[model samples]
Target chain A: MTTLVSEAIRAPYDFLAWLVGLWSDALYAVGDALGIGMLEYVFMHHAFLVGTLIAVMAPLVGTFLVHRQMALIGDALAHTAFAGVAVGLFVNSILGTGISPYLTAVVVAMLAALAIELISEVTDAYNDVSMAIVLSTGFALGAVLISVNTGGLAVGINQYLFGNLATVSRENAVLLVVLFLLVSVVVTVTYKQLLYVTFDETAARVAGIDVTWYNRLMTTLTALVVVGAMQIMGVILVAAMLVVPVAAAAQVARGFRESLLASVVLAQIAVLVGITLSYRYEATAGGTIVLVAVAVYIGMVLAGKLQSRRGVSEEAGTGSVAREIDAGTGESTDD
Target chain B: MSLEGIPSVGVGGVETSRESAEAGEGRRGEGTADADRVVDAVDLTFGYAAAPVVESVSFGVDRGEYVGIVGPNGSGKSTLLRLVLGLHEPDSGHARLLGHPSLAFAERERVGYVAQDVTENTKRMPITVAEVVLMGRFPHAGFGRVTETDREHAREALRTVGIERLADRKITALSGGQRQRAYIARALAGEAELLVLDEPTVGVDAESVDAFFDLLADLNDEGMTILLVEHDIGAVLERASRVICLNREVYFDGSPAAFAGSDALERAYGTNLGLGAKTETDSRGDGS
Candidate 1:
């Protein structure tokens, strides 16, 4: 029965592997046609795929988080996910098991997410002190665990810390695909509830949307996003993918849906361009992507300033028009 | 208008109503007690800390009745409203919304709420006026797609509030008065039987505040039940059919005229001497 269940779960991953193979072959053809050196490698193809998916899911969840002023929650969860990786490595060394560290990270990060939520619920606040404690505890645990292991585990830790583009293995790519689908499907299904909760907790509660449950779900999803992005963006800088693009989009986008779409588009530019630049310069992919995203944010801020300066006069005109209509309708309704 | 025939209950009627509500709660399932009342609170009490914020509050808002709650700043008016809406569970007794226990009241779409300018805090959020109004339909839609009919209702609600022209504009771009109307439109879109507003005109310009009250009067005239919590005693007296003066407890529950005639305002506002002094100074400042 266990084997059957495991096979049932593996079926989708197998299909995703096939899809990844097809993607790599297509990239190879494109590389030959465009004479791109980096796209010739299978690892580069996987890196691009993972980066693209990260761009989509990161901001898709980040939009809700950033608007709610909970952007730091992503950073907090990423640190806990790192601790989770340490736990996995520690247990694997002792037990001689082949369990994926990312799986353990997912489990630990989700638990930490729930802890953060529960603490907030009990204390009636999402204060920075508790979050700081959680973050430090995670990094401290990871450091201690890595020191205690004293072997090849410490050598592989750099990839998880700062992230390595060349380390985007086929299995890691497939895992990300699964996470992308999960995050996308869940967010799509619960979009309205999540949006309502994020926008106004009191009003959402009044609407009977179970604000607490949605909050828990949101944090849990943040844990998943942090873990998935950690494979390429690393533990330290993964949250940049979730926050920076969303902030950039908020600078110019005039509506929630528009901001969400704009953030995804902006993240795509950051990831794709940053990947290419990192390859050219031999820099860390995560650091390059965040730098590009920050640059995009600065550009958006300037554009937003220009738009607002122009919007002032336009808004004054609309204000007068609105008053006129209000007066007209007030009289008509009275009559 | 069914309540029009009932004589205006004066200050003395508070005791009688409490007794009747208690009697009603004693035999709750009899079907005659609370079936017609949209909001029924019988000895409801709640507090965040040691001391009770709302204490032994008892009242019932009949169908289509416009009730306004007025109190001092810390008089637990908002807390009482939260208790009525089941956002905060009462410490003792019970509050019922639309004939069901407030906390367990499942048919949430039947009620609409507009609180004191939440948009002021979320001004940077990129949600359009149309989208905010569309949230009224969210409870109806649940996990399903927002249907065309839902959009039509939202449009109709916007038109009713006379802001259909600005439907596509960002919500934060609107004036405080206009934003409150959009919230009302949201409630209207939901087909809510009861509309609740807590200090709905805070930060609104004086001219717009008058217009906002007129809008409320118009909604009430159209047979919509309204429960309003306002700091502006004059506005509530001018608009509400019934006035509830509260200070941790119900000071008075009666007609607006009766409320004005009684010393309930003085008793409620006088409990906090600093607030009373501040009000005097504020009025003096306004005169100067």
Candidate 2:
């Protein structure tokens, strides 16, 4: 499946042209289903399944990460997985084996999380220092391992660095579907505990939230999300998979749940639009997706800021009119 | 963690050996230990990264007693308060609250704590004072949707604090004193047996200080035990029944007058309590 994606776009807009053909098939199916239009049901079903997979996965967990301020940490750990992938590839090549990259990436990211937690506690080292150490060492070791191998493991490593979504495989997409549901369920069940930990960690600790355990669990879960998104986002730009969707949602979300829902919606929209347009324009799908997500983020931020400014002026004008009434009544407070 | 054998900092600025201090203090007054001691700290010790900042300490506050803790900067007064509040784990000995090993959330609700600043949350402000105060009910009601009973209690607490009218205002919109009061209301909404406040008077203007203290005094009179960490003892001492002076360790624990005029303060500090900063000849407790 990955091999097909690896070869999907032979030229610019190649995939898009194929999608158009697929769309015609979809129109035919829809027309058959409705007996009215030219669209096909099979195409819509396939698009919906794939679109749903892309939209729901990254952004769901991404919102949680962004709300908790672990977005950059997501990026750091993804790179940290590089060393693991590199090491796995070298061992596989040497042993005449082909280890699953997802398995290797996840294992490395978990190890990185363990190392991060350990460093934060046992030493005076800052979180960024620990992240930096994992990131640089991971990439360096991965490079060293790949340099010794004559195969295209180096090119594979570049997939993580630059994201080659064009080459995503069927089995991997199915794996993504399973993972998307798994993460969503786990997060929902532990929603309150997560928010409590995010809001006031110390208070949560004093409240007996078992903060240390939650910290480790959350980091590991975040790693899992990273590994899942890596197929579409690529390793290099995977942090966006963990951050942008959530950040954009946060700008307008009324609460924690609202933010989560908004992020999922935005991610799906961006993924479909980016993938469709990239195929149309003959551009990199992953790059186009990130660009769209970023534009959405900027728009949300600008709109939110304007709304807040308007609210402030309205408040100021109302404040003075109520001032004399307050004084006369001896309420003496705008509060 | 040397809470057992290390000498505590001298009281009233008096640097003396344990033998001399014990022998010298018996004649001062009768040291009455509380029967219903809620906070029992025995040989308590704490440090940041293992260089002992708070030395061996021992003290007890009875149930429903409003004790004010006063000290100079770097005196570890706030550190001691944190230990009692269960924010920082003590290095050694025992710091118990309500017979528990330390403060727990459900248990801590019995112990309301308001830090100095009480900074409003940075996230979108929850609408209404009723909503803000109901946040204090978090220990009792974990997360997700809030209940009607919670809002009712918050309203009752607001009415108690005489700020029921401000019940609808955003917490960020409240003044410094009003905000502090609202925080108190939040703490009070907990219906806590003991309210631990750290420097509740810092940066509050003189009038606000009087009002804050007056409000605190009124609450204390109504049977809520307040363990406060205050910087300026002048106004607080006027209302405080017992004063606990911490300078890396317990300086003295006794009556307010003995604390103000005694050689314990003169020895631990450099001089007697400097008077004339206020307009009142406040009452003081007998030295023991």
Candidate number achieving the greatest DockQ relative to the actual structure: 1
Would you give me the overall lDDT of model 1?
A: 0.86
Task: List clashing residue pairs in candidate 1.
Answer: A256-B126
In order, the first chain's TM-score in every candidate is 0.96, 0.79
Model 2 agreement with the true structure over A8-106: per-residue lDDT tens digits: 635524544455456446657666877743133343333434545656767766665665555677777888777777777777888888777777888
DockQ of 1: 0.53
* DockQ (model 2, Cα): 0.19
Q: What is candidate 2's CA lDDT for residue B139?
A: 66
* TM-score (C-alpha, index-matched) for candidate 1: 0.92
Minimum summed lDDT over a 10-residue window in model 1 chain B is located at B1-10
